[model samples]
Target: MLKIEEIQEIIKLIDKSSINEFIYETNGTSVTVKKSADEYTIQQPAAVTAPPVIQQIEKPAEPVVQEQAPQIAAAEPATSTKKTVDYDYEIVSPMVGTLYHASSPDSDPFVQIGTKVSSNTTVCIVEAMKLFNEIEAEVDGEIVEILAEDGELVEFGQPLFRVKK
Candidate 1:
């Protein structure tokens, strides 16, 4: 567990620093951090000619919440309690294609933080062969995480959600 003082220091550093990416590894855990501009565009590595999915080049005013260190400590021994690894469900891609967060360039994303999603919800779009396909959920659960960026090309079975059962 991270100390409160350390968590505060990390938040301060994140606010004061502008190095869009940061990584820290300690105690067998690795944390990767990124702060993108509103456009939230990601650069494709050289030698990879595929275009990036996210094309927004302008900055958006998303609130910044550097981690504050989990308040609750880890669980006790496994025998003390059943592990909560039983996820309610996961949304996975059906094909290898580019994922899009919105229907169009100037439209709102299909989903956002705290968005309640039901089974068959259209969470995002995946474009293949110049055709846009709506990717829907296969199970009912609150979205706990969006594993891929907007316009990211996801492979078959790639994780798209970390849902609470």
Candidate 2:
């Protein structure tokens, strides 16, 4: 088993290096470190009884390809005199993590469609590395649309809700 200091050292080394993933196993102990975007995940398993098996299979030769004829473009439609443009404000995620609509499983969501919110109102929670981060609406408006579903994995700067001021 690796000590806490050793694990921390391994994590630091992995973060500094260019490699994205590192797996080490010895004496029935296994440690796996993986990097996703700008974050690093470290997982230490209790034990490993056997080494992983990797098998390579040969691929068959590529078949002959045939080119298809190009299609003609369609006629353009007539332009309208008036155009309506949307000016909705998007609430984006601050970090890459799993999005939660509510604080707990049985609790109600912080905000929903048509819910009025201020600049500091909590709208959702983003869980990253076991830390729950409350996400707030940065503009004073009403939620017009929910872009992401509950318990979905969201990327940094991804829009979670659309609000109309």
Candidate 3:
């Protein structure tokens, strides 16, 4: 069983990190921490000697579309003026992590706009839990856009770059 202070510390760490969910188990006790939007929920068994009881917390839905109506309307003209070319492929992040354009701080980015890449060419690195994962282009194409910025926290399946075959 986790003490209150220990559980608080874990919550603090998770809140600061990019992790969406964390689970810890010891003996027969289990603790789960989950983050949804800006809220955090901690779920744990009430006691070790009793049957585990699970409780769920839910939030009421907000009118997100209504709130963004003005912003979408405002950007319509700008989007209409720009030429829309359908991209052939999108290089996406495989996991939730911080995106790094270069292996090191002083190194050049692996790929940039107009840079041609092979299927196996590394385009960027996504650092998750201290592991630096080299992201591949996966398709032969010229990079048309770098969507995510360096050192940005990116979610799983988030587009990192757009490519034209």
Candidate 4:
């Protein structure tokens, strides 16, 4: 495992370099640092685990006291409550990448709230590595909400939009 001083030195090197991302792995340990516009993200390896320590405590024997059970309120009827309708369809990202709402900054977003979309409708662009992949809405529905923001890094299976089916 890398020491704290070593990790701090690595971070300083990254900040001084022009690289957007840096990754290092060795002996089952891995570290990743990603830098974008104004922020930096770091992914550290899981902590090393040690064997559990066993301990013993002595207590004096005493009479057992019974406690009264707490009462729970009765549940209300489901029909008496108002609930918002949920969307059945969601557009998810296919890979880990940065999401783009439009082809260019000056262009309008492909889909907005209440915008109807079909299987062939191109909803957004996901840039991974150096490739730009256009994501489409596989289900026919109206977009109810965009779960991801433009230029944000998205992970695989992350929901990008909620569509009303």
Candidate 5:
């Protein structure tokens, strides 16, 4: 079971972060915290036993208007600006750590959009357990987009960049 101060800290972190919900489990205890606009809610089991799994709705409901179907179809091009890339190579993080786009704060980023990189290019750095390890782009290609945020914590095998040969 988590202490009251720990739970409050987690709630504060969730409020500051963009994450909608946080769930933690240990041994047989489980806790879930969700943030909605200005309200914060925390849920936990009464005893020390684990709680049942809960499915959540990830997205909000979109407004549907049958009569405006044609108008919506005509206005799609303006609202939908995202392009779909069918084939691309992803530069993935090799370890779980904090990702840094540059060696230092004022320094230029290692790679950017449209930057051409070889197989041995150092694209970024991941600091794990106080050690900063330079990450390489294993594929030779031009960087199309950066997927991970600079200085954010990244999970192992998380895609950092999208590249096209």
Candidate 6:
């Protein structure tokens, strides 16, 4: 809370300054005092950060190549070579967390559509409680569609992939 004298002082400062807006910070208290059109406003921040001294970096996109499709297919989902069976299964997330495609920073992914899988095969990994848990296939199927993006936070019962078993 501010004292009446402090409020009066702020009002006096506003009347004196011709600038459209003003802001000041001290101790743990910071206030953004501003005037827009004919309205006056004040906002106090709960947390503060020291203004950074730096420059921004920009990123450029790599050129797309048609030859990379095969590499991307292999890189994104490395399939298993084994027997097959017929089953209808929906690959749902086991928990509420972020979904990951690859196993490690340098490694390729575990599974993708047209990738042969068994009931014990790990299709993807989900992160929960700061721990990565392997999501396995309940039944063998070809991944028909991926319903979520990499590093996307998912909820329980979220359809991660639609499988054609």
The candidate that wins on TM-score is 5
Give model 1's TM-score versus the native structure: 0.48
| Residue runs of model 2 more than 4 Å from their true location after superposition | 1-87
Model 6 per-residue lDDT at 9: 64
- Structure candidate 2, residue pairs in collision: none
Q: What does candidate 5's lDDT look like per residue over 9-96, in tens digits?
A: 7766655555667777776666777656445556655445655454333434433233211111111224567787643699999999
RMSD, candidate 2, Å: 15.3
Q: Which regions in candidate 3 have their CA more than 4 angstroms from the true location? A: 1-85
Off by over 4 Å in 6: 1-87
Candidate models: Cα lDDT each: 0.62, 0.75, 0.76, 0.74, 0.75, 0.65
Q: Model 2: per-residue lDDT, tens digit, 55-159?
A: 222223333254232121222234688544354799999999999999999999999888999999999999999999999999999998888999998999999
Q: Candidate 5 clashing pairs?
A: none
Tell how far residue 70 is off in model 5, in angstroms.
31
TM-scores, all models, native as reference: 0.48, 0.51, 0.51, 0.51, 0.54, 0.47
- Model 6 over residues 1-165: C-alpha lDDT tens digits? 344456446645654444545566655556555543344566667656755222222223333232211111111234679556433677898799989988885778787767877888888899999899999878876876677888887889998876777
The C-alpha local distance difference test score for the whole of candidate 3 amounts to 0.76
Instruction: Give the winner by TM-score: 2 or 6.
Output: 2
Off by more than 4 A, model 5 = 1-81
lDDT of 4 by residue, 1-165 (tens): 556567566656655555556766655556565544445555655642433322222223433254322221222123546455489988999999999999999999999998999999999999999899999999999998888999998999999999997
Which residues of candidate 1, in runs, are more than 4 Å off? 1-86
Better by TM-score, candidate 5 or 2:
5
Report lDDT (Cα) of residue 37, candidate 4.
43
Candidate 1 clashing pairs?
A: 38-59, 38-60, 39-56, 39-58, 88-165
lDDT of 1: 0.62
- Tens-place lDDT per residue, model 1, 126-165, is 8888888898876677777778998786888898876775
Residues 43-78 of candidate 3: C-alpha lDDT, one tens digit per residue: 666435535544333434433332111111111223
